[model samples]
Target: MQAPERIMSCERPDSEEFCYFLAKDYFRFVLDGSESQPAANNVVETLRRSGSSLDRSGRELEHCINKLNLSSIEEVERVLPSLMREIYSDGIDNWGRIVTLYAFCGVLVSNLKKKGVPERELIEGVAQCLAQYTWTHKAAWIKENGGWEKGFVEHFQEKKNSHFYTKIAAFTGIVAAFSFVIYQH
Candidate 1:
């Protein structure tokens, strides 16, 4: 985290394709901004298990949700923040909880859509929240952490972050399939 050489602009992220990939790949399911949105119950379980699949943090979050018998969108909605806050505090080398956090958020947003929440609301709300997160809460941390150029590229490197993986070809194509999150447009 040696200051990333240079911090990047939040508007035009240095590691932009990572955001595009998240939108195209990981978040492709809910990318439909169409008018006729599905009701919460009508939505399938495609993202239901996403949170619990990545790592232990996800499992623990799932456990707490289960233990509380929090099955509904309303129920999990109430308590998930506290549980996630705990996980965020743990940090664990920054990369440990990175993908897990996105999976958890993606699960919740997808569920909200299923529960009849409008896509616009979910979309705008996430955008606003990300703005605050990057500019407000973690601005200093993100700056010192090298912003996306170093953070996104280094953290989600495919196989290994060799010189080969440092170029746009590797950054955009290979690593994108199974890696990356956190910095999204």
Candidate 2:
């Protein structure tokens, strides 16, 4: 069991190869409550601004998730894939979109956690779902883009224009909102 799970997790290889673990770990960083959640924290720290601070981003993210109105796991299952399809409708070329996907997963986990989904079940289920997305939708892209290695990291942090912050704002909103939603339920 653990062996299969370790397979699902992203481990750095000696060579540049596509690894699904990067996506799972990014999601798990939230689901498993790991102390270092660089996906969210890094973006939040980079885009820290008044009225759009980390705390505020969470509240705003809560508002965005509320707009989705996902009250049940069934609804989450039915709707999230569709939302994901729409989210990646263009392409996963930019860091903002990738972060938005991260934010989206964060929102779903928050929903599940709020609805009292068991922790082990939630982690396994979400990891599997993300793994599906990893192999199906984004594997080639991850391989081409840098597989969370120098390529992805370099692109992710380079804030070249003002529009980047807008994306950061949206992503942060999703990240910060989870805890509030989780506790409320």
Candidate 3:
């Protein structure tokens, strides 16, 4: 499940390629009953191949997961609120970031579901977070700037543009992975 090379870039805080690769890798790990160490190593390799740094948000997620020492629904319930807060408050303000959050949540929920854990609460929590911080604000911002298509086009075409398609690819990859996870549930 290799992402296209051209989709890799360092500028985006949550690279779409990285998010998709991480979620896909994690989902596979869960399905395969593999240990977390292999998944983490794969994530590092994927990040390197994508030419994306593991930014603060990614590191924070790793730290939260490691510190919690749980892989069940309890872990998702305990860590998600703080994770969402940090991602929204201090992370990049972009569609990719929002999509990354959605993808991450989707992966967690899917994993829980596969483990036969009741996932309604976690799913609702994710929905609430997205409704409050992501979809609502993103919709308003897009409306204020025109619609999504126009807004994104204009935003990417502005001065100092670099790796515009890479950003779009990342966004697309995240959305695709998010959809896949959601479908699995």
Q: How far off is residue 101 in model 2, in Å?
A: 0.8
Ranking by TM-score: 2, 1, 3
Tens digit of lDDT per residue, candidate 2, span 1-185?
24454443324322222223443454455555444544332223332221122333445555657766665556666665655555555453554555555555665676668778765565555555555665577656766776555545555455444544746644544344444344443
lDDT of 3 by residue, 1-185 (tens): 33352235212313333334444443443334434344234223332222222122243333333444445665555555555555454333564454355445544555466566655554544445444444434555545654433544344345123544544544544444434433432
lDDT of 1 by residue, 1-185 (tens): 11221122223442332233232233334344332333221111212222223422234433322334433444444444444444444343243334444554454555556667666566445433433333444445545766544654444443243423222232132123222111110
Please tell me which predicted candidate would have the highest TM-score against the true structure: 2
Task: Work out candidate 1's RMSD over C-alphas.
Answer: 13.4
Q: List the residue pairs that clash in candidate 2.
A: 9-21, 10-21, 58-176, 58-177, 61-173
* CA deviation > 4 Å runs, candidate 2: 1-8, 12-20, 31-58, 160-185
Question: Distance from true position, residue 85, model 3, in Å?
Answer: 2.3
lDDT values, one for every candidate: 0.38, 0.50, 0.43
TM-score of 3: 0.39
Residue 157's lDDT in candidate 2? 51
The count of backbone overlaps in candidate 3 is: 0
Task: Please give each candidate's TM-score.
Answer: 0.45, 0.61, 0.39
Residue 69 lDDT in candidate 3: 43
